[model samples]
Target: MKKKVIVSVAATVISLSTVIPLNVTNPAPTEAQETQQQPRYMTRAEIPAQYKWKTDHIYSSKARWEADIKKAELLSGVFKKNYQGKLAKSAAILKKALEDYSTLSRIQDKAFVYANLNADVNLTNPDLQAALDRAEKMATAVSENTAWFSPEVVEIPTKQMNKYLQDKSLSAYKYVLSDIIRTKSHTLSQDQEELLAKLSPLSSTGSDVYSRLSTEIKFPKITDSDGKEVQLTQTNFISFMESKDRNVRKQAYEAYYGTLEKFKGSFAQSLSSHVQSHNIRADVRNYKSALEAALIPNDIPVKVYDQLIHSVKKGLPLMHRYMDLKKKMLGVDELHMYDIYTPIVDAEEKYISYEEAQKQVMEGLKPLGDDYAKILKEAFGGGWVDVYSTDDKKSGAYQWGAYDTHPYLLLNYQGTKGDVATIAHELGHAAHSYLSKKEQPYLTSGYATFTAEVASTLNENLLWNSEYKKAKTKAEKMRLLNQRLENFRTTLFRQTQFAEFEKAIHELEQKGESINAATLKKVYGEINKKYYGKRMAADEEIAMEWARIPHFYDHKFYVYQYATSFAASAALSKQLLQQGAPAVKRIKEKFLEAGGSSDPISILKGAGVDMSSSKPIDEAMTVFEETLNELEKLINEK
Candidate 1:
């Protein structure tokens, strides 16, 4: 018999493409321009309609969304009645059952999308949050009803399953069926699967608690460089960290991390519980480790995860060299954590308006061909983006949508160069989803998390090159180069550090060790020390940094993809820059448009990057070393 495993619909929550949070800085307006330029909006209505997404595109009214929820719930009962025992009767019956299941899932997915998109824009609104709660309950019900699917399918006699697989009618679901069969050993009994699905709603308790605390916790005010007191906020903390004045950065860092420190106990509880849940699930599913449980569902090997940490650790000295360069450029006696974010070039930063950011993103992505250009134009004008930082809006950025609607992006776009890159990054996700939905069946429309970052990071790399080509001065080039190098630090090295920390915590839990605030801080601080090296001033606040990462609460084993995808994108972007149209053609056909029709590794290999080997990671580090070399040369020339 196949290994017993439970596949819950809750796993589908990751369809939303969220980028790892980066401390992107927005330029503060001068005092003289304060009256003319407001950096943030107090309400959604204060922003222009063009900058907001059309949530109505998904559902024209609340009544319509409610109707779909009811429709999905009703269909869930019908599905359980019709296909619960008849899945293996015949090839035609199996195909019909799968199609009906897809239809029901699509409706549930759409309803889930509407509630989440609304809740995200204004997390403070009770009505929206209530609606989101209802949507989650409905999704769990749908999952519970359809919980018999894989078990029954796996129970089909092997000879009969081979006949069904050979049927032309089931050709579209070929990969889907094969993957389900591949997990036969992991497929649990129908009763056990149903029970697990019933408990799926409880799985998100820790994540929900952390989300509320992170958004609701208030921080004290600090004096800005302009001598004006501004309240420290999650949205602007990064901006403060990037301030030209050392005192502003220091105050922001201390205030932010200090407040988080007060809530460390609660944060630690949330994280420990989250880790414990993964461990229990892994044990129940009979997996060797929580890491294996998380990776295997996505068809990712544990070795790939291990190799990322291994490769990144080998590249640590290069990161140290970059840090040493930062010390030299900033002329700091001690390179404290706060000093790391400020631009070392000492030049005034320019603000890029949302409209200007769109133009830059459009121009940057031009190499993807005219077909993609048309999609880009529609994505910009079709109201696919919700821009500007407004009160109660969610922090960070992501792209999400249903199969029936165009992809949508939620961004707190500040007029900064990094914000411009973010525009390109999120749009890459939107375009990938849009194309995949247009080309693939609903069952295969969503891509795996493993491959999600490839398009987004590739867009950023292209945007970097485009902006670099436009740089007219040494200072401008240096600033752009520094930003690129910073990407290597944050996206590649730093995320792997997070991945390592995540793995360590899960292992500790499996060993029956007690996990609390002190444990989390020690583990995170040690990892941070190794990655940043001895040059960084030892600060207790750095340990508290782990408390702020939302991904740890929401998604297990997710950060490593940022590192892996960066490596893959570096390889793909090189081909695009050098080979031009032919490379773009292959990437779209083999990668973006493939969706989840095949495993992530095979899809990427088809696109000309072999992630199974260390070549991509090694190549990416070489680029990082080369970038440091060029920057050093430019600095010496002066």
Candidate 2:
């Protein structure tokens, strides 16, 4: 899903899309790196040029970047002077204003991406960081100047708006104009809208504080399986949990969550304030609840959110069955929370180099047909990806770029099976953005977050399926099968668990109940227990887990799409395998290339999955059940 820097316009906020990658980090850290010599990427200078993204393609120098920022500033002033209150005067005026807005938006996006891309690779560089700040400031200023657009457009009479919609000159902006009219009830007067825009920065203060606090946290050190002391970190916590040594996992788990336990009150206060902001905004906007306010703007039905929670709750027995199998496979007396991340079967961990990763991604993605394959080939050596970890390079992976340029990816790639999957996942995002920008206008080129992960997750399914078919041993099959089951577990079940918590807190706040540390922990622990079922030990330390989730602070009600999108892709993957080229055609034309030109549900329906109903969720559950059955049968064999 894309991240947005929201600039309040009326009761609603205008969202500028930012590249937020769904990181498929190395799931199982290799023992070879611990014992053997490995290639070092100590700095950007040491990294080969081929492995670096082509940032020059975006802007060659700081001077050029500065020039665009200056030009954008001038354009924004001119736009405001010329069209501030003139949008509803005539169809021709509205068409020109929108075109100018599009051009300005594109330039601003390019400037922002260039600064952030360079800054991410060289975090220690002050110049790059300054440039990024300047770009961000420019974005905020530009958005503020254009805050009048929505309110003015909505103020137009319905009779006149209909006539304008039929005019060919305004055809490019028809959907946007219609959307504005759709929210007319929610749109405030121009003066009120400007006041809200001015107050927008205060809304994100709690989120900013949380970010600073979390980043500054000092995780306690613990003894590793090697019997040496290692400092725990947010990034490496999960890897430690996957340790073969149960004591190491227990230490890491207790130390990590225990450290979080120290700051529970501060985290609770920050989170409570954010919840208050959501409720206040919803009340001002005339929405029935915070959930409606969040979902309505995206054209998503509240029922879709409800259906996910209901279906997943009904499917919890399957999850309980999974936990029972996990306990049996590990031969443990009791399955504690710490034991969940450790693999139940041992499979060989292979170190795949970046070049090998390229080959695997291309070959694995071949089922999508020639057009999709061609894009994959172009992405490999076309200067699209930064393929290794270097000092001060931002951690994890993501796909991002302006619509005018080819998509760019930043990855701290360590050659594991998970790294190969990351390539496919990020490239799927790149391919989707690439095709959408090529086919659609600037107004609709960016797709909704609701459908964002469908392409990426489907790519993962295709790649893994290709690899699973090639497995020569039972262990390999078990490992990959278990990996798929883990995807369903984390993305579907765990995220729904989060979605439930988010809904509960907002509802509590809406009901005028206090939301503090005690309330949050009580709610999160209960949901976590419910999702994991009775087989889990439901450790007390796990209750503090709510404090560490950055998503809750930054994005509200956003996790459910991870579950919904995963289900959609699972259903689509089955169709791709069974139906072949016809399925590929539908996926490419109706889904990948459609972009925001249509509603997300409509686009998905055109691509052959109907998320508006329960079938996709049910299909995903069936997949999880079957995978578990196959893995259990293998584990039970003499």
Candidate 3:
């Protein structure tokens, strides 16, 4: 039998793909120019009608949403009758109940999607809000009603379940039954399970409140580059960060973090409560740590996490070398934090328009083969993507979709070099989902977070490689290589630093230490110093950086996967590019095709990667070192 383990609430609530807190900075505009520029905000009707999904067909009115809610409420009775006390009976009934569950789930998903998409756009709309509220309640009810299936299946005598699985009619559910039996050790009593289920909403309230506060609360006024004061907000902070003037970047950083500092205690409390919730849930079940609990669901080995931190720590010198190169390229006497983002290339590439970005993404991804490229092209051409950033637009980017519909991507597309990379990154996810949905059963279509970043990062690596080869001059090549290294350092090293900080805090909590703002800052400062090494000054405010990361509040220890996935992708991309179609085919079949059908390790091993060894991480770091060498050569030659 598989080893017995308990899953924690953190494993469920703090999964990957949490929000990234980006500081937006709008360019300082002259009064005349400000008058000339059109308002950036778009009304619901003004938003291109094509971009909105045809939700009328799904639910024509609020009354329809209510009716569906009623139907969903009615499903509890159906589920109870069909699934309760019937697991010991014939296999046909079990199969029928599973089918029923899947069908009802599809309906629930559609209803929730319909309500959520509309409400997200117009948060103040009462009808949409009501629809969303109803949908959430219905979902919780369904979760509570279905909670018994796993425990009951596990409670069935193992011999009996195995015997049932051998029957011709029940063999299809062999994996499903096996998984249930494996979870027997973690299953709580019906009352305890119900109580936990009911507490979920309240437990999640801290994260919900943090989201509202962060996104909706007004920030203070700050002076811009021209010395004119303007109100700072999440929307405008991006433009500020990308400011051409160093003073502006510094000012923006101070102003933005100043706001977070003012509310640091609030943010700290929210995050601490979130971690505490995870600890409590993990303790209730039988898990060694929140990290172990988080890994159990996806069967990711703990060593993978350790390897990521260790390898990235070993690679920090390479990063510091890259940092030094950036300073030299910029011809600065001393590089400040503000100088890191300034264009390293004298003739930086122009921002690609959204249309051009789409074409470039397709061109860059062509090596993935025609069928995959074609689906991406269709997604780009179709209104599946909500492109472009606007005032009050959702911050950051994501690939979102219901299992039944074509994947939809929400991008805050500003026409920048990084924006082009973002396009490739998000479409990587879209293509992965598209392929998985087409290739696997609904049950297996959704992949765990571990493999999710591989596809996305692979596309990014491809785009960088394609762009690097096409550069005309040494400077251009250096610039492209610099950008690539910067991506690696930030996505891999910086995120690992975050992972380390998260682990430290959780361990502190586990040790019965109270987590407050001062403690968070001190711990974060130490981790930042350790990860970045002594080469660069670890700014005190960088400690407050923890408060700004939404991932910590929502996803505990999830950032490490970005480091691991990218490292694996870097290695995979190298194999595919140098070794040819056979390697590419192997990756597509073993990594992409396996989807969630197998454990992450098995899936990666099938793709010719063994995370148990340090080879992939070593290869990725070697790439970083090589790129650093190339940058050094370019500088010396210049």
Candidate 4:
């Protein structure tokens, strides 16, 4: 299982490649994107075609998608009947069964890639929404139909499975089969698996409700520095925080958190029910706990989870020191949670055009050999990215596609330096998918989420080093270093804080304690205090922060990987800088190209960063400490 588990087809609905050939036309950007007087958000229909993804690569028309869905459903029936009771006949038969599963699964993925991407670009489209709704349900059906496959395979004795792994015909599926056998203890009976598969669609109700809350809930409008009324939104909340005016930041912070605060009860229930779903599934599987259950499929040891918290706790003083420096540099009497995100450096606001961003991404990722660079180039030119902000578009960013088509990225790009790093980050993911798809069979094409973030963050580190060398002024250098610091703060510290909170809540529920609104608030507040230390006030409203983090509802035990991956990436990037081409070769061949062929920790170890040890994370913190020391020195320079 990936970090965000693909339990059902609908889950697959939200999920990616090819290259070296360039038969596709790359359109030039629109004049507005190239040169705009004032930046403003555009509706989806208004965005230029060049800036949008060519989903046509997946399906030329709705008829093609529908035809594929119908064919897949029919194929699903035959697949279920043909392999239902026949897998134990021979090794060859088992391989055939698994191949058929991958084939049918790819069919659903293509259908879903088309429908889900369509809905994302224009989230308000009723037609697209209806199509996606059907796709979601179809995904559930596919899961239920094939629910017996794993259990049947798991029923085969481990010795027999080891023999099956030796079969030449099952070479590609060797790891897949071995993994299933390893989970034999956790594997449920066929009927229970089917019932659980059926329950998946229902399990998503809380997630759907949480998703709707982002758009449906009306937030209070706040006044900007210019005395203009502005409605606070997920898209602009952080943007407002970046304002030079403290009042605007405070108002935006209060308005957004205040809105989430009102719905704490609802979010609390949604989150608790969501956590309960995880506990119920884990309990039925006879796993020791929810965290163990979640970690098992990915081959992650519970120690890895505990070690991250343990290691991070040892480094709390560094986090507190950074906060203390932020207060001194900003000359604030008290550091409020809202006071963060304001720039400490004096660099003038700059916007790197989307076209420029693509070039920078190319330059940033060039160290990974020319073949990898070519793949990224194809992703940029081949419309693998849907760039720019638009009305009713999904906020935030992600890379998703089907096995048949190359990876596609969805971003509400706003042309800031941060956005440039984002382009590099996402393209790293797209590049990983391309290499994996080109190298591995469809079944192992997708890398686990544990390993996926490594590629992205490593790119950012490389980009930071390259650009920092080019900084001509102290302020420019300060800005870049500060941005890196924020990554340490946000991706490392903040996510670790989240990891701890999630662990506590799950443990509480496992102990049969109530996880209601009050309990949730109290637990979150306590964790916030510990994470931020005495420097942070642990504002009353900060306790409600968990309410807005959708991953708790969408995927349990997820955020911790953000911290861990950053730690691993920081270590790998250091290796790359020191070792050069050989390091890049190891990264691609051992990590990105490996895909799901091996356990994630082993994959990372092969690439030179061992997650099982505390060294990588501690080394990552060392980078943070060095960065802070540099920033503090710069602040004090005459």
Candidate 5:
């Protein structure tokens, strides 16, 4: 099953490793405080000159990106005028059109990436923000103009296209054309498709407005555990939650949710509009439901979604046990939401510097074969990663690249254990992109979300396993195990809970039921209860959790994929670690090389997983159970 997380507020132009909640804002510290505070902006000069490879692309300056934006605008007319009605005349024409479109798209990709990267570096810069907005609008306009291309290609008579494929001139586009034909069943009429295309901007307006408000609006002040007042900006709020102090975590949580509660009605409206947009589009395309329509394009089976939810639901008892163990380790009389963030075993919490983290990550991933490890080592050594978080730096980490350019990772690295894990995660994405781009054609390099998170999560699992084994003391081992369980619970079970809420909301909208703040809270509250079980209180503040999540506003029913992918990753990582070379060979051949050449299910099956059955999910749940049992045993012994 696919699970959605929070979506970035800027442009939904490219796929990133993960989605940060949009409300995550990092405002500039006041001038008086600036002297004492770390510089909010990292100067380019401050970046090690040797690490220039961290950003391989040259479109770094806003002025350069603005020039590229103009260049992209020039190609808009070419696609708009030439390919409109001429697509169906001949196979040769179709092939040429596809080539031209791909070339234009590649150029646009560079421009959009440049703009976004620039904007992300400084959200306070108006010029960069304008550049991003203009580039996205241009891309959308061009996309709408070319909307007829796919439907038209799909409308071509199958026999005629088959005969055309027999000619040598059209053979290069055989796969592309076949993919178009594969969508024949989903294509709407030309007029309906055109209408939907035109309406898309309007339809997405709700999300756009929500993004603006969430990212730009200021939140009220909240007190921290130290009795110091801090502004509840997006960046600080998340930082506060990650605090080792229980009181600080609780204060941050309540403060953030309290702000969200005030805007609950607006959030509900935006969410409703997004859901309605999906339902209407699915209906127009003649699908049974929005979920089916969303999955169909990626060739995912609806049964996969069903099996994921069902299997994860069956694992709820394990989650409850894990929570209970956590409470016991914390020496709390009762486990409240506040106790969740505290580390299980007390140690001098180490902060691995970015350099050390990179070195550790390279060592941890050695099991993926020497070649894989070599590339990873080069990535670190060659400056492929931008580390260190500064004020106005993007709030989260992500790996991004065009097929023509090497993958680059942007990280807001805070020296925390979680930050080390994040380094592994982003590099996993970079490695996957690197391998896919090396082995597959550009057209096939980008896989769907169903398979995308596997590589990243696998690296994280490997890192955790390595760390767990290396710990010397029982306290250290228990601490590492606790951290691992926390990751599983948050990434897997928590995401599944989010998925369930998304599904319920979509269903309600489909039934023409009005979605308001009260209704959303009630529904989410119930799902919260089910996932957490009876071990912890489902605090009323938790109901507003849905509103705080930006994913619900952007991607429709997308959170489940996180749970599914992490489950798949756990199983794959265990096999590779235990079974060695044969497992590694199978993973590389079946999963990595398969790319978008086959559906996700087939790819996973080839790599020794069957999402069609409940085996993988069940096995993942079993891992969770074992971890919980280990924690329980440790607590009892203590």
Candidate 6:
């Protein structure tokens, strides 16, 4: 998901995370002194000042945020009156107009992030929540006010726009101008665009209902391997799956999805309505399909989507081979769906403190050189992250910041190795934004998700390899290898399966077909059966998997970027390791610092991976097998 950029009128892309609702209740004051004490769990005040992000660097106080909001609101009206009919009058006018809009946008974004970051820390706060709500609408209102800008720009004939481009004064906006012209066909009239803007909030209705229901409904608790009861949650499902106990995995699976099954109709309707909303928007915009509408804005073609699904289907035999390896290594009589997540190498459990996690990340990113390492150090020490889970902090993790502020990370850090890898992954995002914002103007600072995952996942690969080389024993190496392989399997293979499922559903919706809970389950089960092959069984509960994936409701045709990004990053990671400094230099200069200065695919090409071809993906698939082979070698030796 793209980070929320509420500041820009030209683009208002908000990325959705796991979407778990924070259902925290305020605890009654203890008999002891009660001046803002921590809740039964930790509270916002209990978190160390160092661990919480210092947003004062962005804005000193809420008053400042409010003042900026007023300034932006004032500018929004002046902006429309000033540029509504005169974008093509002169090159100088066009340049100045864009610059002013950029300035107002930066202020708006800063205000938006300030309020929202405060709210994220203590989700139960009414004051900050209200401020955050106002900021969201204020930003959207500005966008709605400026809805005519794009269509107005599109009205200018390309030949005349090219003539305007002859002015060296507008050189900075060359690609931005070209992109507007390129997408001119999709640009609608001012009235139509405004209508769509008014309808935008309504589009999220289905998703909103889905989020509220999922968040409020409590799943059943079950016994862990330790015989103590554990609550199942979106955050801890995978953690439970990591247990050595197969029954624990089975019960967790059944219990989690079992709760989801009861709400299948509601979940199905929410998803169906969400997909229909996208389809309707695409139709109104004259796009051929919902997928085309989603992909075209990012400069991706239909064939890239087709090519990915095709290639993955062709590679199912290799996937099955990996599954068979898992079964053989586990020595199970028959591999059930529950057996897949069991760790093949039961290494001694180790907890890495957050301090050590930062150190390891800094050390692991060394191939990128001292400057990159220095950025990671600054991010760690500079209060650019909220490092612990207390009550009701947003679930899962994401890297979010306004163009004016440095990136702020939200983490629910346990001391597990996976947590360390997550630090590397998220810091990769922070570092990318840090570097890009330093080099590019506000208009160019935000990179697209298609290329964004490359930086994050590349860091993951680097960190895993760094740790793998240091493993003291075969068991340690196997654990690291096992962890690393699941990433490729999930990001490259599983997400492609997801990508294909999304395509099938969208096409079904396009044909005006009904897709209820049973329809979704049937399609999802068939895909899993084909992807996992005969070696692994698709649990009856597995079909209900679609019920919980936030991405399905959050963004249309979005998850494929994860697969595409991993392919590019894996290829680039190998290059950086093998080709050394030269490759590192190319990736840093061409990709990381590139930002949205170019289209996503072009930025990827500039970094040297041509996603238009399947070669990078194929190379990544090869690594998956090599990992299995190494695992087989280690296990047999043991």
* Reference-based lDDT, each prediction: 0.84, 0.80, 0.71, 0.81, 0.72, 0.78
What are the TM-scores, per candidate, against the unseen true structure? 0.95, 0.91, 0.89, 0.95, 0.88, 0.92
Worst 10 residues of 2 by lDDT: 7-16
lDDT by residue (tens digit), candidate 5, 1-638: 01111123211212322211222122233342344332243564565443334332445565676676676667766776887777768877777787777676666666666666667666767987887789787666666666777777777777887887687887655655676677687887667776776776776766776766676556667677778887667766666776667777787777778888888898888888888899988998889999998888777888888888888888888888777777776787777775676777776765555556776887788789987786676566554566655455655677776655566677766557887898888777777767766666545556666877787888999999889878898888888888888898888888888888888988998999998889999999888888887878667788888766766776766678878888889889989899999998999878876556667788888998776787878888777778877866776784
- Candidate 1 scores a C-alpha RMSD against the true structure in Å of 4.7
**What does candidate 6's lDDT look like per residue over 73-144, in tens digits?**
889889899988899899988898889888888778778878877876676678877997888788777777
lDDT of 2 by residue, 8-104 (tens): 1001011113322323222232344454323466689987677788787777787998999988878987988999878778888888888888888
lDDT of 1 by residue, 545-620 (tens): 9988888998889889989999999889889999999999999999988888899999999999999998899999
- Stretches of model 6 off by over 4 angstroms after superposition: 1-42
After TM-score superposition, the amount by which residue 426's alpha carbon in candidate 4 deviates from its true location, in angstroms, is 1.3
Q: Candidate 1 vs candidate 5: which has greater lDDT? A: 1
Ranking by lDDT: 1, 4, 2, 6, 5, 3
RMSD of each: 4.7, 4.9, 5.9, 2.5, 5.8, 5.9
lDDT of 4 by residue, 105-184 (tens): 88888887789888887877899999999898778788888888888888777778778888898888878777777778
- TM-score (C-alpha, index-matched) for candidate 2: 0.91
lDDT of 1 at 610: 97
Selected candidate, larger lDDT, 3 vs 4: 4
Better candidate by TM-score, 1 or 2: 1
Instruction: Give the runs in model 2 whose Cα sits over 4 Å from its true position.
Output: 1-46, 122-126, 389-393
Model 1, position 85: C-alpha lDDT score? 89
Highest lDDT against the true fold, candidate = 1
Cα displacement (Å) at residue 174, model 4: 1.2
> Could you tell which candidate, 2 or 4, scores higher by lDDT?
4
Q: Positional deviation of 113 in candidate 1, in angstroms?
A: 0.5
